[model samples]
Target chain A: MKKNVFTTVTLLARSAGILLFFLYLGKGIQFISHLPIPGSIFGLLLLFLGLNLRLIPLDYVLPTGSFLLNYITLFFVPVGVGLLQYSDLLSTHWLTIVVSSVISTIATLISVGWLYQRFAK
Target chain B: MIYLYLIATILVFLVSRKLLIPIKSPLANPLLVSILFFIGLFSFTPLIYQDYATANLPFIWLLEPAVVALAIPLFSQIKQIKKQFRAIMISCCFGVVIAISTCLSTALLLTDDKILLLSLLPKSVTSPIAMAIANETGGLASLAAAVVIAVGLLGALGGFSLLNLCKITNPQAQGLAMGCSAHAIGTAKAIEVGNEQGAFSSLALVISGILTAVLAPLFAWLIGIIITI
Candidate 1:
């Protein structure tokens, strides 16, 4: 009976946490729409404020947060698939995208790597 | 209709997680798995991309708060972040400049599409910052999102492999480089390498994001001036 109760509480907490996340997500969207910045960006800022103010404990939300984070890539699947509609755009500009991405990545690696090596001393 | 896409997303996630463990390679990355799944689905189904996107919109909406949640880790490490304040500031500035300049220069020389150029500007930063930069620079947020994911996947798949090739055996160096360059995806790889590396990498990801957000516009302005002159 004790174990079952514990399980129930945990499940309740998880559901509650997810609910709170959605609530905040809604508020975040609303906040962003009125601002000059993007809604999602605003939502992130609101989340930061909530965490910093201790209105929400990381521990309480971590299970849900981590679950979301883990599958972040999956969230982008639809976007990637949407790229199919832009295949002609991609093909025509393939060289530019490929070259820019590769060069920028290498440049980032070198700059950050060098800086870390220097200051990590 | 949208429910079907959500269901598909959940199914893909489950299958990818199971398949990823056995491969132990970035190629088997969950994001890559989902992307491939979506691709196959799109190819096989007659459903238009628009309908699929409309159904998947909620997931996209989640991107903002999820990024903000990254600040949770940053807040947790506040003390350490404070201690390394100067180093972090300087490194962030340098990282941002290099990231923006390289991307812009390459794009200018290689392509003339203003839209694509704008979209690519924020590719190095985390998604939120990338989206902001794209918006400020007159790019589509959705396009920037695509670029950021592509950059992240490239980093996750090839970062460690590249580190090994370069004989960069130091965990701290590897983690910092990966995190700064690759953001979350690289940090994921960093965690697999070790705890210390993961911690440092996570630190780099946050710092780089903050720095990139502040600097992308300034660098773009400078690039614009140089081009005009």
Candidate 2:
């Protein structure tokens, strides 16, 4: 029992450590580029490229990456709760908001899908 | 007391996810359920929102790195993605253009509020990028966050049904559309559909995010020019 607990702790620590390393690497590059893009997205690109280039071994991130992905939605729960802060505005303009979002979402979905389907064919 | 707040957030998420297995309805989305729980806690209980927010710092901090971790699945499908790179790129660019234009026009049809317009402009992008675009375009970042989620939820709920209606059988097409229109939430939904869909969705997500971040500012500038004229 004690050994299993220690192993789980070690795994969690290793996962966070590697991911944080990549995150900072991405932030560093973004800083140098002076682009307005978020560092996390930059980190994603860096990790992808690093894997393709074989600079970062797949095994290093895979175990932790999959572990992280399983809880991906959990990470966003806190941020989504922040939406409550705008409940007042959301209530007042609910009509405009819903109408626009629905129309916009459907329009983009159709346009993008149709265009891609045609292009692929 | 602080422990109760933290435990409540985690407990709600776990129970909500368990409930989702039986419900299978997107409206009962785990994230939505979690958010609603906090809303109820704040409204009915003596528990304060600010304290709850403070307790959630650990989860919030994980968000960025979690995004970074998306590279794993993305890398897993690189071979297939590379085979059709040009088509995917073109589709993503086209999607970006359509997303911004339609969202802006639809919102304009309803209201002429600049902040609302700008907030909805990046509604198709992910949260972090959307917030940045909203801030740059003179919109309320907080409102943009909510607008982005609203749009995401809509796509997640109806994206597959809508794709079927459009006769888009191609997983690539469906994935790209969902990612381009709905961002992360939609991508999550796509991932559940298939691996190919997940990869393409994430690819489209990255490309569309970059495109929107670049083009949204230009769009705002163009709108400003037209508004002044």
Candidate 3:
């Protein structure tokens, strides 16, 4: 039991370290370049390239990735809770909020889905 | 104090997940339920949103690395993904355009506040990028973050059924729609649906984010034209 637990910790630390390194590299590049894009995005691209190049073995990060994906929903709770900060603004402008969020998301979903479904032709 | 807030957030989330499972509806989404739990929980406690936000700072920081980890899913699905790359890119482009236009026109129907309009411009993308875009375009970052989360929640809840209603049988189509329209929350839901969906959604989230960043100014300008008329 101790051996298995220790192995899990080691794997998590190593994988997190590698992911954080990429994340920082992305931040550095974005800082220097004055890019409009988010650093996390740059980090994501770099990591994808690294994997494609075989520089980082897939097994090295797969467990961490799966774990993150599994619980990504939980991570959004805090930010979602940040909704409290704007309750006043939201309530007054409820109409605009409804129209924008509801209509926009539905339209985008339908259009993108419809467009791509036809793309195979 | 901090531990109290952290413990509350985690406990609320875990319990919400467990309780929401048997019900099995997106409206009862665990994230939505937990957020509501905190929002309600706040009214009873001496704490405020800022306190909870501060305690949960680490989770926000984890978002970027989580995004980086998305490369794993992308890598896993790369072979099949490459075959449909162009189609996915084209669909994402259209999705971004649709998201912006619909949001702007609909919001314009009710009000023309520049800051609010600018903030809503990036509502369809992930919160981090949405906030950045909102700030760069003379919008309130805080408002942008709020709107982004709202949009993500809305999509995460209704995106699947709506896609099905539209007869979008293709996983790639469904995933791309989720990513571009819903961003991170949608991607999270897509991951729950299946790996292929998750991979494609991540790809579209990144692509749509980049597109929105590059075109944010144009949308901002469009808002100017929109309100002036």
Candidate 4:
């Protein structure tokens, strides 16, 4: 029971820390520039640098980070559901989406792959 | 009242996971299945998109933390990434440029609207990052997210065939291709191929995402200049 309680507390604390960091960057980005990239992306870079530079303890964020990553898909469900709102846009642009995604995806794969093989040697 | 949406999402996802266990195909991704399930559920039920949004606000907020949490895998892979740092960086840069430019040029030809261009700008990245970028660029975040999902599904399902058709057999190349193009779903497919492929794909996923996040705004600016000219 003691161990379980400790685990729960740790999870909560770590998760709160991660959330706080994200919010921090979100607000900071708002102040800095109205850039299109989300603050979360900057927050990720910050956390990554912090860990790499040993500014933040790995254990402090590891559990919460892994947990959130594991369920990242769940978090996007709302966005997917937002698809309901764009039925018209989707229908009108379905052909473009299908053809473009396919062409662009293959184009990306070939270009990246060719470059890696060309330069890796 | 709002909790109902959460409960239903979890249940549907679990059911979808169980059903896909035997099929073992990338096309049967739990994310796609769950999203479709929820879309169906909302259609039949009295709940509307706004109702779902208001109720599922917490999950939507979770997207921010989820993006931040991406640092963990990236950090863990730092040592390995450092070993091939130059190669990885070069390939990622090339991939991002190719991916964004192709999408942009294609979309530009297909549509005269700027919002659609914004929506497709971030389609190469993961969904959360894509949605965030889309929203910031004055596009519909929902449209971006949906497009990202479809892109992921398409990559997961068709990636291998494309690779084979191109005669690209190098694991690193294959992984980078998938991760750069498909994002997470393609990473999943790469993991199935081999550990080396998985590692490279994960690295590509992170690098491509970061590169897109950093470079997309600049690309938008350049495109704006060109348009005005």
TM per candidate comes to 0.78, 0.91, 0.95, 0.81
Worst 10 residues of 3 chain B by lDDT: B43-52
Off by over 4 Å in 2: A1-12
**For residues A5-121, what per-residue lDDT tens digits would candidate 1 score against the true structure?**
997679657734643564567466657564333444344455556767887666766765665555555666665566676666566767887898888888777666667667854
- lDDT-best of 3 and 4: 3
Interface RMSD of candidate 2? 1.7
Which is the winner by lDDT between candidate 1 and candidate 2?
2
Ranking by TM-score: 3, 2, 4, 1
Task: Show the lowest summed lDDT stretch of 10 residues, model 3 chain A.
Answer: A62-71
lDDT of 1 at B226: 59
- Residue B75, model 4: Cα distance from true site in angstroms: 1.3
Model 2 over residues B10-73: C-alpha lDDT tens digits?
A: 8888998887888755577777778777888787888678888888888777777878888887
Rank by lDDT (best first): 3, 2, 4, 1
When sorted by DockQ, best at the front, the candidate numbers are: 3, 2, 4, 1
User: Tens-digit lDDT track for model 4 on A1-121?
Assistant: 9999999888779766865776587659855976544577667778878888998878888676667666666665676677787788788788777777778998998888888888774
Candidate 3 residue-wise lDDT, B1-229, digit = tens:
7757888888988988888888856688888888888888887787677878898988888778899999998998998788887788789898898899888888888888888889889998888788889889999988888888888999999999899877897888888999999999999999989888888899999999999999999989888886788
Q: Write the per-residue lDDT of candidate 3 for residues A1-121, one digit (tens) a residue.
A: 9999999999988888889899999999999988777888899999999999999998888767777778888888987888888888888777888888898999999999988888844
Which is the winner by DockQ between candidate 1 and candidate 4? 4
Q: Which candidate is the best by lDDT?
A: 3
Question: For candidate 2 chain B, which ten residues in a row score worst on lDDT?
Answer: B220-229
Per-candidate DockQ vs. reference: 0.43, 0.70, 0.81, 0.53
For candidate 2, the clash count comes to 0
Residue pairs whose backbone atoms clash in candidate 3: none
